[model samples]
Target: MTARPILLAAALLLGACSDAPSPHDLSEEAEYFEVSDNSNNTVPVAISLRPIKLDLEIPRHHLASIAHPYKPWAKTIWDRVNLQVLLPDFQFRNTQNLAEFNSQDSADVLRYRIGGLSSDQSFVLLSVNKEYQEVDDFADVHLRAYVNRRKYGNQSEESIQARQPTMFVVNESYLRTPSEKPIVLSCNLRRCNASMVIPASNWPEADRVDFGGTQGVRIEFNYDQKYLRQWQQIHNFVLATIASYIHYPESVL
Candidate 1:
Protein backbone atom coordinates (compact mmCIF):
# COMPACT_ATOMS: atom_id res chain seq x y z
CA MET A 1 0.00 0.00 0.00
CA THR A 2 1.15 3.53 -0.74
CA ALA A 3 0.36 4.63 2.83
CA ARG A 4 -1.76 7.54 1.69
CA PRO A 5 -5.20 8.56 3.02
CA ILE A 6 -4.41 7.17 6.47
CA LEU A 7 -7.65 7.51 8.48
CA LEU A 8 -6.08 7.23 11.91
CA ALA A 9 -3.68 9.85 13.21
CA ALA A 10 -1.62 7.18 14.89
CA ALA A 11 -0.80 5.71 11.50
CA LEU A 12 0.85 8.97 10.53
CA LEU A 13 3.72 8.21 12.87
CA LEU A 14 4.88 5.51 10.48
CA GLY A 15 5.61 8.18 7.88
CA ALA A 16 8.70 9.27 9.80
CA CYS A 17 10.64 6.16 8.84
CA SER A 18 12.81 6.70 5.70
CA ASP A 19 12.07 4.74 2.54
CA ALA A 20 15.71 3.86 1.68
CA PRO A 21 19.27 5.18 1.66
CA SER A 22 20.64 8.01 -0.50
CA PRO A 23 22.72 7.61 -3.70
CA HIS A 24 26.02 8.91 -2.28
CA ASP A 25 26.12 6.05 0.24
CA LEU A 26 26.25 3.54 -2.62
CA SER A 27 29.36 1.42 -3.11
CA GLU A 28 32.23 3.25 -4.84
CA GLU A 29 34.24 0.13 -5.68
CA ALA A 30 34.66 -0.84 -9.33
CA GLU A 31 32.19 -3.50 -10.40
CA TYR A 32 30.77 -4.32 -13.87
CA PHE A 33 26.97 -4.21 -13.87
CA GLU A 34 24.00 -3.39 -16.09
CA VAL A 35 22.07 -0.23 -15.27
CA SER A 36 18.31 -0.07 -15.47
CA ASP A 37 16.86 2.44 -17.91
CA ASN A 38 15.35 4.39 -15.00
CA SER A 39 18.69 5.21 -13.34
CA ASN A 40 20.08 8.62 -14.38
CA ASN A 41 23.75 7.44 -14.42
CA THR A 42 25.22 6.88 -17.89
CA VAL A 43 25.38 3.25 -19.01
CA PRO A 44 29.08 2.84 -18.17
CA VAL A 45 29.09 4.85 -14.88
CA ALA A 46 25.97 3.03 -13.75
CA ILE A 47 27.48 -0.28 -14.75
CA SER A 48 30.58 0.60 -12.68
CA LEU A 49 28.32 0.70 -9.64
CA ARG A 50 25.84 -1.80 -10.93
CA PRO A 51 23.37 -3.94 -9.06
CA ILE A 52 21.47 -0.86 -7.77
CA LYS A 53 20.86 -2.60 -4.49
CA LEU A 54 18.95 -1.18 -1.56
CA ASP A 55 19.11 -2.10 2.15
CA LEU A 56 15.89 -1.56 4.04
CA GLU A 57 15.47 -1.75 7.81
CA ILE A 58 12.00 -3.05 8.43
CA PRO A 59 10.71 -1.85 11.80
CA ARG A 60 9.54 -4.61 14.09
CA HIS A 61 6.11 -5.31 15.60
CA HIS A 62 4.07 -8.07 17.26
CA LEU A 63 1.08 -10.17 16.14
CA ALA A 64 -1.17 -12.27 18.38
CA SER A 65 -1.89 -15.85 17.42
CA ILE A 66 -5.50 -16.78 16.70
CA ALA A 67 -5.08 -20.52 16.16
CA HIS A 68 -3.91 -22.37 19.29
CA PRO A 69 -4.61 -21.04 22.77
CA TYR A 70 -2.94 -23.67 24.91
CA LYS A 71 -0.10 -23.86 27.47
CA PRO A 72 3.10 -25.07 25.89
CA TRP A 73 2.24 -23.34 22.63
CA ALA A 74 1.80 -20.02 24.37
CA LYS A 75 4.81 -20.30 26.64
CA THR A 76 7.07 -21.70 23.99
CA ILE A 77 6.12 -19.03 21.47
CA TRP A 78 6.74 -16.30 24.01
CA ASP A 79 10.24 -17.46 24.94
CA ARG A 80 11.55 -18.69 21.63
CA VAL A 81 10.11 -16.10 19.20
CA ASN A 82 12.68 -13.50 20.24
CA LEU A 83 15.13 -15.52 18.19
CA GLN A 84 13.14 -14.81 15.00
CA VAL A 85 10.37 -12.33 15.80
CA LEU A 86 10.86 -8.75 16.94
CA LEU A 87 9.44 -7.48 20.23
CA PRO A 88 9.11 -4.00 21.65
CA ASP A 89 12.38 -4.61 23.48
CA PHE A 90 15.29 -2.18 23.00
CA GLN A 91 18.19 -4.46 22.07
CA PHE A 92 17.66 -5.64 18.48
CA ARG A 93 19.84 -8.78 18.40
CA ASN A 94 22.61 -6.27 19.20
CA THR A 95 20.98 -3.50 17.12
CA GLN A 96 21.76 -5.44 14.00
CA ASN A 97 18.52 -4.81 12.08
CA LEU A 98 19.19 -1.09 12.10
CA ALA A 99 22.93 -1.32 11.79
CA GLU A 100 23.03 -3.50 8.68
CA PHE A 101 20.76 -1.11 6.72
CA ASN A 102 23.27 1.63 6.02
CA SER A 103 21.69 5.05 5.25
CA GLN A 104 24.51 7.41 6.15
CA ASP A 105 27.67 8.09 4.08
CA SER A 106 28.76 4.62 2.97
CA ALA A 107 25.69 2.68 1.79
CA ASP A 108 22.56 3.88 0.02
CA VAL A 109 20.05 1.13 -0.85
CA LEU A 110 19.32 -2.61 -0.82
CA ARG A 111 17.90 -4.77 -3.57
CA TYR A 112 17.55 -8.51 -3.42
CA ARG A 113 19.46 -10.42 -6.12
CA ILE A 114 17.64 -13.67 -6.54
CA GLY A 115 19.76 -16.38 -8.07
CA GLY A 116 17.08 -17.19 -10.65
CA LEU A 117 14.16 -14.98 -11.49
CA SER A 118 11.03 -16.98 -12.03
CA SER A 119 9.40 -13.66 -11.41
CA ASP A 120 11.04 -10.78 -9.53
CA GLN A 121 9.74 -11.39 -6.02
CA SER A 122 6.64 -9.41 -5.18
CA PHE A 123 5.73 -8.35 -1.64
CA VAL A 124 2.80 -6.78 0.13
CA LEU A 125 3.32 -4.26 2.91
CA LEU A 126 0.16 -4.38 4.98
CA SER A 127 -1.02 -2.06 7.71
CA VAL A 128 -1.27 -4.11 10.92
CA ASN A 129 -4.81 -3.26 12.02
CA LYS A 130 -6.61 -2.02 8.93
CA GLU A 131 -7.56 -5.53 7.83
CA TYR A 132 -8.70 -7.39 11.01
CA GLN A 133 -9.51 -6.95 14.70
CA GLU A 134 -9.76 -8.85 18.02
CA VAL A 135 -12.31 -9.50 20.79
CA ASP A 136 -13.01 -11.88 23.70
CA ASP A 137 -14.42 -15.21 22.56
CA PHE A 138 -14.28 -17.82 25.31
CA ALA A 139 -15.03 -20.55 22.82
CA ASP A 140 -12.71 -23.52 22.34
CA VAL A 141 -10.14 -21.67 24.43
CA HIS A 142 -8.64 -20.62 21.12
CA LEU A 143 -4.88 -20.41 20.92
CA ARG A 144 -3.51 -16.92 20.43
CA ALA A 145 0.12 -15.74 20.34
CA TYR A 146 1.73 -12.51 19.21
CA VAL A 147 4.40 -12.39 16.49
CA ASN A 148 6.41 -9.77 18.32
CA ARG A 149 8.60 -8.68 15.43
CA ARG A 150 7.58 -5.01 15.36
CA LYS A 151 9.01 -4.55 18.83
CA TYR A 152 12.60 -3.46 19.43
CA GLY A 153 14.98 -6.38 19.86
CA ASN A 154 13.70 -9.09 17.53
CA GLN A 155 15.50 -8.95 14.17
CA SER A 156 17.20 -11.71 12.26
CA GLU A 157 20.88 -11.73 11.34
CA GLU A 158 21.66 -10.00 8.03
CA SER A 159 22.44 -13.26 6.29
CA ILE A 160 19.39 -15.01 7.66
CA GLN A 161 15.87 -14.09 6.54
CA ALA A 162 12.29 -14.74 7.48
CA ARG A 163 10.62 -17.53 5.57
CA GLN A 164 7.19 -15.95 5.92
CA PRO A 165 5.57 -12.57 6.15
CA THR A 166 6.22 -11.04 9.61
CA MET A 167 2.62 -10.33 10.54
CA PHE A 168 -0.71 -12.14 11.32
CA VAL A 169 -4.33 -11.12 11.96
CA VAL A 170 -7.66 -12.97 12.42
CA ASN A 171 -11.19 -11.71 12.44
CA GLU A 172 -13.04 -12.12 15.71
CA SER A 173 -14.52 -8.72 15.10
CA TYR A 174 -13.77 -6.88 11.88
CA LEU A 175 -14.59 -3.52 13.41
CA ARG A 176 -12.45 -1.38 15.68
CA THR A 177 -15.24 -1.63 18.26
CA PRO A 178 -17.44 -4.58 19.26
CA SER A 179 -20.46 -5.44 17.18
CA GLU A 180 -22.98 -8.27 16.79
CA LYS A 181 -21.78 -9.16 13.32
CA PRO A 182 -20.14 -12.36 12.09
CA ILE A 183 -16.42 -11.85 11.69
CA VAL A 184 -14.89 -13.75 8.80
CA LEU A 185 -12.23 -16.21 9.93
CA SER A 186 -11.14 -16.76 6.36
CA CYS A 187 -7.62 -16.19 5.04
CA ASN A 188 -5.74 -17.14 1.88
CA LEU A 189 -6.16 -20.88 2.18
CA ARG A 190 -2.70 -22.50 1.86
CA ARG A 191 -0.68 -20.68 4.46
CA CYS A 192 0.43 -21.29 8.04
CA ASN A 193 -1.86 -19.68 10.65
CA ALA A 194 -0.83 -20.69 14.17
CA SER A 195 -2.97 -19.52 17.07
CA MET A 196 -2.41 -19.11 20.85
CA VAL A 197 -4.44 -18.52 23.97
CA ILE A 198 -3.37 -15.40 25.85
CA PRO A 199 -4.78 -14.55 29.27
CA ALA A 200 -6.54 -11.27 29.78
CA SER A 201 -4.74 -10.78 33.05
CA ASN A 202 -1.35 -11.25 31.39
CA TRP A 203 -2.14 -8.31 29.15
CA PRO A 204 -0.63 -4.99 30.19
CA GLU A 205 -3.84 -3.42 31.46
CA ALA A 206 -2.20 -0.01 31.74
CA ASP A 207 -1.25 0.21 28.06
CA ARG A 208 -4.16 0.47 25.70
CA VAL A 209 -2.05 -0.57 22.73
CA ASP A 210 -1.17 -3.90 24.33
CA PHE A 211 -4.88 -4.60 24.67
CA GLY A 212 -5.90 -2.84 21.46
CA GLY A 213 -6.14 0.59 22.96
CA THR A 214 -4.10 3.42 21.38
CA GLN A 215 -0.99 1.79 19.95
CA GLY A 216 -0.55 1.92 16.19
CA VAL A 217 0.58 -1.35 14.61
CA ARG A 218 2.70 -2.11 11.52
CA ILE A 219 3.26 -5.81 10.84
CA GLU A 220 1.84 -8.80 9.00
CA PHE A 221 1.68 -12.48 9.97
CA ASN A 222 1.33 -14.72 6.94
CA TYR A 223 -0.30 -18.18 6.83
CA ASP A 224 -0.53 -20.99 4.31
CA GLN A 225 -3.81 -22.49 3.02
CA LYS A 226 -3.78 -25.42 5.43
CA TYR A 227 -3.29 -23.13 8.40
CA LEU A 228 -5.90 -20.72 7.08
CA ARG A 229 -8.54 -23.46 6.84
CA GLN A 230 -7.61 -24.69 10.30
CA TRP A 231 -8.16 -21.22 11.73
CA GLN A 232 -11.55 -21.13 9.98
CA GLN A 233 -12.62 -24.22 11.82
CA ILE A 234 -11.35 -22.94 15.14
CA HIS A 235 -12.97 -19.56 14.56
CA ASN A 236 -16.35 -21.10 13.75
CA PHE A 237 -16.11 -23.47 16.70
CA VAL A 238 -15.33 -20.60 19.06
CA LEU A 239 -18.23 -18.52 17.80
CA ALA A 240 -20.71 -21.38 18.09
CA THR A 241 -19.48 -22.29 21.58
CA ILE A 242 -19.35 -18.80 23.04
CA ALA A 243 -22.20 -17.02 21.32
CA SER A 244 -22.04 -14.41 24.09
CA TYR A 245 -18.53 -12.99 23.48
CA ILE A 246 -18.47 -13.30 19.68
CA HIS A 247 -20.78 -11.53 17.28
CA TYR A 248 -20.67 -13.06 13.80
CA PRO A 249 -21.93 -10.14 11.77
CA GLU A 250 -22.78 -11.45 8.31
CA SER A 251 -20.70 -8.98 6.39
CA VAL A 252 -17.77 -9.39 4.02
CA LEU A 253 -14.41 -7.86 4.97
Candidate 2:
Protein backbone atom coordinates (compact mmCIF):
# COMPACT_ATOMS: atom_id res chain seq x y z
CA MET A 1 0.00 0.00 0.00
CA THR A 2 2.83 2.38 -0.77
CA ALA A 3 1.45 5.60 -2.16
CA ARG A 4 2.16 8.17 0.50
CA PRO A 5 3.81 11.31 -0.86
CA ILE A 6 2.24 14.25 0.91
CA LEU A 7 5.63 15.64 1.92
CA LEU A 8 5.68 19.33 2.85
CA ALA A 9 7.62 22.13 4.66
CA ALA A 10 8.90 25.19 2.80
CA ALA A 11 8.74 29.01 2.43
CA LEU A 12 9.20 32.35 0.49
CA LEU A 13 8.66 36.15 1.02
CA LEU A 14 8.99 39.81 -0.15
CA GLY A 15 7.53 43.40 -0.37
CA ALA A 16 7.55 46.91 -2.05
CA CYS A 17 5.05 49.07 -3.93
CA SER A 18 4.12 51.36 -6.89
CA ASP A 19 7.43 50.81 -8.68
CA ALA A 20 4.86 50.48 -11.45
CA PRO A 21 5.59 46.75 -11.89
CA SER A 22 3.23 45.79 -9.11
CA PRO A 23 1.52 43.32 -11.37
CA HIS A 24 4.69 41.28 -10.88
CA ASP A 25 6.24 42.74 -14.04
CA LEU A 26 4.56 40.16 -16.19
CA SER A 27 6.85 38.72 -18.87
CA GLU A 28 6.87 36.00 -21.50
CA GLU A 29 9.27 34.86 -24.19
CA ALA A 30 11.56 32.42 -22.41
CA GLU A 31 11.51 29.93 -25.25
CA TYR A 32 14.66 27.75 -25.50
CA PHE A 33 13.99 24.90 -23.13
CA GLU A 34 15.90 21.73 -22.06
CA VAL A 35 15.71 20.38 -18.53
CA SER A 36 14.91 16.73 -18.84
CA ASP A 37 17.76 14.56 -17.50
CA ASN A 38 15.93 12.53 -14.84
CA SER A 39 19.35 12.16 -13.24
CA ASN A 40 20.91 8.63 -13.00
CA ASN A 41 23.94 10.31 -14.53
CA THR A 42 24.39 13.99 -15.32
CA VAL A 43 25.99 16.79 -13.33
CA PRO A 44 27.79 20.05 -14.08
CA VAL A 45 28.14 22.83 -11.56
CA ALA A 46 29.53 26.40 -11.23
CA ILE A 47 26.72 28.93 -11.18
CA SER A 48 26.87 32.51 -9.90
CA LEU A 49 25.22 35.79 -10.75
CA ARG A 50 24.85 39.21 -9.16
CA PRO A 51 21.70 41.30 -8.66
CA ILE A 52 20.16 41.58 -5.23
CA LYS A 53 16.85 43.07 -4.10
CA LEU A 54 14.82 42.28 -0.99
CA ASP A 55 12.43 44.25 1.14
CA LEU A 56 10.55 41.80 3.39
CA GLU A 57 8.63 43.07 6.38
CA ILE A 58 5.38 41.15 6.29
CA PRO A 59 4.13 41.47 9.85
CA ARG A 60 0.42 41.34 9.20
CA HIS A 61 0.39 39.19 12.31
CA HIS A 62 2.89 36.97 10.52
CA LEU A 63 0.19 35.91 8.09
CA ALA A 64 -0.71 33.15 10.52
CA SER A 65 -2.65 29.91 9.81
CA ILE A 66 0.32 27.75 8.74
CA ALA A 67 0.93 26.54 12.25
CA HIS A 68 2.40 23.06 12.80
CA PRO A 69 2.52 21.19 16.07
CA TYR A 70 3.17 17.70 14.78
CA LYS A 71 3.43 18.54 11.14
CA PRO A 72 0.19 17.80 9.36
CA TRP A 73 2.56 18.27 6.47
CA ALA A 74 2.30 21.96 7.24
CA LYS A 75 -1.43 21.94 7.45
CA THR A 76 -1.40 19.75 4.42
CA ILE A 77 0.75 22.26 2.60
CA TRP A 78 -1.54 24.96 3.83
CA ASP A 79 -4.62 23.34 2.44
CA ARG A 80 -3.15 22.99 -1.01
CA VAL A 81 -2.48 26.69 -1.35
CA ASN A 82 -4.10 28.73 -4.13
CA LEU A 83 -3.28 32.31 -3.04
CA GLN A 84 -6.08 33.77 -5.11
CA VAL A 85 -4.28 32.25 -8.04
CA LEU A 86 -0.84 33.45 -6.95
CA LEU A 87 -0.50 37.07 -5.68
CA PRO A 88 -1.41 39.19 -8.70
CA ASP A 89 1.67 38.11 -10.66
CA PHE A 90 4.26 39.27 -8.07
CA GLN A 91 5.67 42.49 -6.63
CA PHE A 92 4.77 44.25 -3.43
CA ARG A 93 5.38 47.01 -0.82
CA ASN A 94 2.66 48.59 1.23
CA THR A 95 2.92 47.73 4.90
CA GLN A 96 3.10 51.45 5.20
CA ASN A 97 5.84 51.55 2.62
CA LEU A 98 7.66 48.76 4.50
CA ALA A 99 9.97 51.15 6.26
CA GLU A 100 10.45 53.09 3.08
CA PHE A 101 10.97 49.82 1.29
CA ASN A 102 13.72 48.52 3.52
CA SER A 103 15.41 51.85 3.44
CA GLN A 104 15.54 51.63 -0.33
CA ASP A 105 16.93 48.09 -0.54
CA SER A 106 19.72 48.23 2.02
CA ALA A 107 18.18 48.45 5.41
CA ASP A 108 18.75 44.66 5.11
CA VAL A 109 18.49 41.92 2.51
CA LEU A 110 18.82 38.17 1.75
CA ARG A 111 17.76 36.40 -1.41
CA TYR A 112 18.90 33.03 -2.80
CA ARG A 113 19.16 30.52 -5.66
CA ILE A 114 21.96 28.16 -6.76
CA GLY A 115 20.83 25.18 -8.76
CA GLY A 116 23.09 23.86 -11.57
CA LEU A 117 23.42 22.08 -14.94
CA SER A 118 23.72 24.19 -18.07
CA SER A 119 25.55 24.24 -21.41
CA ASP A 120 24.94 24.42 -25.14
CA GLN A 121 23.97 28.05 -25.66
CA SER A 122 22.54 28.88 -22.26
CA PHE A 123 19.85 31.33 -21.17
CA VAL A 124 17.77 30.82 -18.03
CA LEU A 125 16.51 33.59 -15.80
CA LEU A 126 13.71 32.61 -13.47
CA SER A 127 12.22 34.64 -10.64
CA VAL A 128 9.57 33.67 -8.05
CA ASN A 129 9.36 36.14 -5.20
CA LYS A 130 6.19 37.93 -6.02
CA GLU A 131 5.79 38.19 -2.26
CA TYR A 132 5.09 35.94 0.75
CA GLN A 133 7.09 36.40 3.90
CA GLU A 134 5.29 37.96 6.77
CA VAL A 135 6.86 35.30 8.94
CA ASP A 136 5.74 33.96 12.29
CA ASP A 137 6.76 30.41 11.60
CA PHE A 138 6.92 28.98 8.10
CA ALA A 139 10.00 27.77 9.97
CA ASP A 140 11.29 31.29 10.07
CA VAL A 141 11.49 31.36 6.26
CA HIS A 142 15.03 30.78 5.00
CA LEU A 143 16.35 30.71 1.44
CA ARG A 144 19.25 29.46 -0.75
CA ALA A 145 16.81 28.18 -3.32
CA TYR A 146 19.00 26.41 -5.92
CA VAL A 147 22.19 24.43 -6.52
CA ASN A 148 22.40 20.70 -6.73
CA ARG A 149 24.96 19.04 -9.00
CA ARG A 150 26.65 15.77 -8.19
CA LYS A 151 29.11 16.07 -11.13
CA TYR A 152 29.00 16.52 -14.93
CA GLY A 153 29.51 19.51 -17.22
CA ASN A 154 31.09 20.94 -20.36
CA GLN A 155 28.68 19.09 -22.60
CA SER A 156 30.50 19.91 -25.81
CA GLU A 157 27.84 21.62 -27.93
CA GLU A 158 30.82 22.19 -30.22
CA SER A 159 31.41 25.76 -31.56
CA ILE A 160 31.84 28.17 -28.66
CA GLN A 161 29.38 28.05 -25.75
CA ALA A 162 31.19 27.79 -22.46
CA ARG A 163 29.84 29.19 -19.17
CA GLN A 164 27.22 26.84 -17.72
CA PRO A 165 26.50 26.74 -14.04
CA THR A 166 23.28 28.04 -12.46
CA MET A 167 23.94 29.74 -9.16
CA PHE A 168 21.64 31.96 -6.99
CA VAL A 169 21.81 33.29 -3.45
CA VAL A 170 21.00 36.60 -1.74
CA ASN A 171 21.61 37.47 1.88
CA GLU A 172 21.25 40.69 3.86
CA SER A 173 19.96 39.67 7.26
CA TYR A 174 21.22 42.58 9.26
CA LEU A 175 18.69 41.65 11.90
CA ARG A 176 15.71 39.26 11.96
CA THR A 177 18.19 36.37 11.92
CA PRO A 178 16.92 32.77 11.92
CA SER A 179 18.37 29.39 10.90
CA GLU A 180 19.73 27.09 13.51
CA LYS A 181 19.03 24.33 10.97
CA PRO A 182 16.12 23.21 8.77
CA ILE A 183 17.02 23.91 5.12
CA VAL A 184 17.69 20.41 3.91
CA LEU A 185 17.54 19.20 0.25
CA SER A 186 18.76 15.63 0.61
CA CYS A 187 17.25 12.92 -1.60
CA ASN A 188 18.98 11.86 -4.77
CA LEU A 189 16.91 8.70 -4.94
CA ARG A 190 14.00 8.85 -2.51
CA ARG A 191 13.20 8.62 1.24
CA CYS A 192 11.91 12.13 0.69
CA ASN A 193 13.55 15.15 2.32
CA ALA A 194 12.60 18.23 0.32
CA SER A 195 12.41 20.51 3.31
CA MET A 196 12.67 24.33 3.21
CA VAL A 197 10.67 25.74 6.08
CA ILE A 198 12.97 28.73 5.81
CA PRO A 199 16.15 28.14 7.84
CA ALA A 200 19.46 28.77 6.07
CA SER A 201 19.85 32.54 6.06
CA ASN A 202 23.60 32.63 5.47
CA TRP A 203 24.57 35.70 3.49
CA PRO A 204 28.30 35.61 4.16
CA GLU A 205 28.84 38.54 1.83
CA ALA A 206 27.35 36.35 -0.93
CA ASP A 207 30.75 34.62 -1.23
CA ARG A 208 31.78 37.01 -4.07
CA VAL A 209 33.53 36.42 -7.39
CA ASP A 210 31.15 37.61 -10.11
CA PHE A 211 32.97 38.67 -13.26
CA GLY A 212 29.58 40.18 -14.11
CA GLY A 213 27.85 40.03 -17.49
CA THR A 214 24.76 38.01 -18.44
CA GLN A 215 21.96 39.83 -16.69
CA GLY A 216 21.60 36.95 -14.18
CA VAL A 217 22.28 33.31 -15.13
CA ARG A 218 18.86 32.09 -13.98
CA ILE A 219 17.81 28.73 -15.49
CA GLU A 220 18.99 25.55 -17.23
CA PHE A 221 18.36 22.41 -15.27
CA ASN A 222 19.16 18.69 -14.83
CA TYR A 223 19.47 18.39 -11.06
CA ASP A 224 17.80 14.98 -10.93
CA GLN A 225 14.52 13.38 -9.73
CA LYS A 226 12.98 15.94 -11.99
CA TYR A 227 14.59 18.46 -9.69
CA LEU A 228 12.16 17.17 -7.11
CA ARG A 229 9.41 18.67 -9.18
CA GLN A 230 11.24 21.95 -8.74
CA TRP A 231 11.27 21.46 -5.01
CA GLN A 232 7.55 20.81 -4.97
CA GLN A 233 6.87 23.64 -7.31
CA ILE A 234 8.74 26.00 -5.05
CA HIS A 235 6.92 24.60 -2.07
CA ASN A 236 3.57 25.11 -3.61
CA PHE A 237 4.63 28.49 -4.89
CA VAL A 238 5.57 29.67 -1.45
CA LEU A 239 2.46 28.08 -0.09
CA ALA A 240 0.31 29.96 -2.47
CA THR A 241 2.32 33.02 -1.67
CA ILE A 242 1.55 32.81 2.01
CA ALA A 243 -2.00 31.99 1.18
CA SER A 244 -2.23 35.29 -0.62
CA TYR A 245 -1.46 37.31 2.42
CA ILE A 246 -3.36 34.94 4.64
CA HIS A 247 -6.66 35.25 2.90
CA TYR A 248 -6.37 38.93 2.39
CA PRO A 249 -9.60 40.86 2.82
CA GLU A 250 -8.82 43.78 5.04
CA SER A 251 -5.88 44.79 2.91
CA VAL A 252 -2.34 43.36 2.95
CA LEU A 253 -0.68 46.39 1.45
Among all candidates shown, the one with the greatest lDDT: 2
Model 1 agreement with the true structure over 1-253: per-residue lDDT tens digits: 2221111111121122243443234323222222223433222111000011111111122111112111121121111111122222212222344443323421211111101001111222334443322222223333222222232355554422322222333333532211222122222323332222222232234432232222211112232333432445434432232222211121111
How close is every model to the real structure, measured as TM-score?
A: 0.20, 0.20
Tell me model 2's lDDT, rounded to 2 decimals.
0.25
Error of 2 at 211 (Å): 44
Model 2 scores a TM of: 0.20
Model 2: per-residue lDDT, tens digit, 10-32? 23222333333322233222212
Candidate 2, after superposition: displacement of residue 186 in Å? 14
- Cα lDDT of all candidates, in order? 0.24, 0.25
